[model samples]
Target chain A: MSAQSEFDREIALDAADGEPGTYRGQLGEGWRIGGGINGGLLLALAGHALRRELGETSADGIPGHSDPMAISAYYLTPGVPGAVTVRTDTVRRGRAVSTGQASLVQEDETGREVERVRVLATYGDLAAVDGDATTTATPPQLPDPEACVSAAQAPPQFLKHATLLERLDLRLDPATTGWAVGKPSGNGVIRGWFRMADGREPDPLLLLLAVDALPPVAFELGLPGWTPTLELTAHVRCRPAPGWLRVNLTSRTLSGGYLEEDAEVWDSEGRLVALSRQLARATSPRR
Target chain B: MSAQSEFDREIALDAADGEPGTYRGQLGEGWRIGGGINGGLLLALAGHALRRELGETSADGIPGHSDPMAISAYYLTPGVPGAVTVRTDTVRRGRAVSTGQASLVQEDETGREVERVRVLATYGDLAAVDGDATTTATPPQLPDPEACVSAAQAPPQFLKHATLLERLDLRLDPATTGWAVGKPSGNGVIRGWFRMADGREPDPLLLLLAVDALPPVAFELGLPGWTPTLELTAHVRCRPAPGWLRVNLTSRTLSGGYLEEDAEVWDSEGRLVALSRQLARATSPRR
Candidate 1:
């Protein structure tokens, strides 16, 4: 058998023997952003649980409601690398789509279980979706992967405490990396190409993580502290083609200590695969 | 006491005497578009319930976590104008923010209660939010409300079955209202000025309703059938100044029988007050 990809192994969930909608998993290391695990990774964990609970064939002989069409997650606390529990609840089951909710919980130092993230998702069969395909948004222009600067090779200051960068091959658009050297573009935009280091093909589930893999857009605006996501919503439009995924993240408005970052993920086939928007706390640059 | 505005009377909720976290409210008339209630109004119902549940003073003496910062809702079934029961669950209460979930339920013709919408929201005090304010987005430009075409006086065909227009003073940009006639601009953009007919001021909760008030962006794309929103997420940034709020809605892509519409609501002071994104079914233009 082929070796399992790091992402697959990290997000793998074991269903509880007696619990119909409960699963257990582990928060693997090497995915921490500052003092906690990445928000996207945490969301992917909940998404996986929701998929497992809602992907079953309906009693009415209906099938193919496996892919997550829309998912939203609210981050309550930062996740740490440890054993975690995910409890799923089927909100509604219909012929075409089913909705489910999942909560990721972890045991704190005091032995109390604390909720890390709560997610709500709707599942449907992407293959059954057929109709008009129109787009006014195009893939962001960027140099080829080889020409872009590898995030792994970014300045030491930029790579500090971001172990998650080691697990993915992220190539940032050179133009937007000015913040690494104390020269921010002040444009509040970040574009990059993302793929698993092991070259695992992208799927609807993984797109949840891909949408938030890039650095916070506030970096380009000269604000460099860790921006914690408060809430994030992702819409998986279609299955992505195999290859590098182009990502563009932009922050349009920052008010009241919060910023809304919108991301668009495009596949190598130039198809728009997923779109996401997140609300996060905006922090000022460190002195 | 001053007379209650129609909006205030319509959205008023009565606490369930025995249920700690339950409230009942009517869906109200004149808010129907097609055969179902507007998604925004349904969301507002749920938001009101969450506010009542989470707006209490914390035991830790933390004050001002009342306004909803981010809220997401999944539309499970079409909401008809009737009595709705909202049940809220407090997910977590923190010093700075509190998260809660609410589900709107109503009885169907069969006498079985049906869940219409499920919402998850994070609440915080908008008044206490202070820090660096930065924005790359500016309010969309549009002709004065007097120069624009009032939706109430729109073409008869365009005003058909839309009683909600009579409650809100909506003036659409003349350039983008071509869709009302058979000449769509084909730009998938809608800009307008929005205000309650009774001169009610926009609040964090009302902004939820205002964000989804405009016509579907698909209409400008020459596809004019009813677009049912599958999921929607709105972030209320701050309180608005009393005046006609400018709203701009845009659709960037339509694929797999779905499209994402993003809306930005700017107050009279030109400060962005709320932002929303929704995924909806895209329908073909009726021949």
Candidate 2:
């Protein structure tokens, strides 16, 4: 078995100091839209950095509470492609859960340190928890990967330059991919399959990307252009098993040119891995 | 008009210094579950403090971004009843949006400072925005407040001591409030009407409480007991009009003893005023 894959290499960050929570890394080229890197990718990087810092060092003699229960990030500024620093502070540590904050920073054009993203997350050891377990929510019925349309094919002109989209094997359920061709379903729902292009084992961090991988569901409402996310919060219920993650994204309200997206990520095991909601602005397609 | 109503008196916090961002206050008696105070009320306090700090004073020549766009809080510790300090720090100041962090702190039994809650929020100026305005989501149908059952009456024994519940007049939609009588609707949806008991105007802060005011929808799914939330994030779409806020709360999944709740608050004007999603654990009732 290979020790490391390109997917891991692209997302990995090295600790800047002997200190455990301070790390520095740069996003790969072409892994961006306009001047900013993908929000999901940035979230994943921050989640990974946080997991490395808090989870691995739990004093309970247990390996880690690598299970990400909840995480939210605010896109404070545009994260340009360059060396970025991630600093995490473990805020509180308890028996069953831990809380921390991670900030993603980088220097801007004038060489001033610009904070790009601020993320707060919580981790929990499910084994330590006691409660009733049940799920009434079912995964959306979707076409098998082999039968779906790959987002990589027939890309919209605006997204043609987003090579990062190619790294994730994203296939849209044919019925929901109509917006790509200018014909929207108008139902404001999108279903698809998301898996790492390199086929790495699925983990909590990967689930973060899967939830945000899809374009805003509002695009189907005939609203054009890039929808920039203002804030995103994701909840991870449990560790996911390996296999393609099924994504169901829905927009409940599109008001004042602002929309809120709700998403669910279900693993092949039929287990709900993560739930996410984001607030974003629907900027019309450039005239 | 009275300078302070009982509802406002309970939720209000005094600024600690001439400094606009710092505050000192205490959660009112009977406003807790177990030893911790209510998360919704904590969020409301932070939002009020933030709005007071950012909105009341804007050098932009325009008013402050009193319109809260998004806010997320991580419960780090059980916020016990005590004199607590809330410190706010402005993270970023922009023309249209401002981001900040608020920390709710208290001294523990050992006299050590414990950070009970950490919140990050973003504010916007709706007046500064332009574009298509519309709301595709509609409020759920419900009986008039007079026809509905007040959550105030027939209180669940577990919440009998909660005085906070009395401050907020929450009436349930008859169709979904069956859980109170031990009937599981098995639908996992709860509809209700929420307004300040003292008849205060329905503002963004009060909407925060309204979103979380309902008992966990899972309770109606045969999942018994307190469902303690681990993290909650709310998006205030626009300033709400004066009147009772209509609330719709739904849970898409309850898996691995965890659940995610999505809530929408519509003002009497039928406009979407706030959107929220929460991640929580479903701890069953004691045997």
Best by DockQ: 1
**Which regions of candidate 2 fall more than 4 Å away from where they truly are?**
A1-3, A18-20, A59-63, A126-133, B18-20, B33-35, B56-63, B127-133
The lDDT of each candidate is 0.88, 0.79
TM-score of each: 0.96, 0.93
Cα error of candidate 1 at position B200, Å: 0.6
Off by over 4 Å in 1: A1-3, A128-132, A157-160, A284-287, B1-3, B129-132, B284-287
Of the true interface contacts, what fraction does each candidate have? 0.79, 0.59
lDDT of 1 by residue, A123-182 (tens): 998975442368888899999899998988766765677889999999999998898777
Identify the candidate with maximal lDDT.
Answer: 1
Candidate 2 lDDT score at position A122: 91
Interface RMSD of every candidate? 2.4, 3.6
For candidate 1, write residues B1-287 as lDDT tens digits.
12398777777899999998999988876898755898998888888889888998867776636798999999999898888899999999988799999999999999999999999999998985442358878899999999998888766765666778888999999999888887888899999999999888888888999999888888888878889898999999888888989999999788878889999999998888899999998765544
How does candidate 1 fare on TM-score?
0.96
Which clashing pairs does model 2 show?
A: none
lDDT tens digits, residue span A1-287, model 2: 12285556756888887867898887777567644688888898898888877787566574556667899999888777778899999887766778889999998778899998999999876543332346677788998899998877755675665767767888889998777788987888888988878888777777887778776687777775778788999988777778888999988667667888888888888877788999988886854
Q: Evaluate model 2: give its lDDT.
A: 0.79
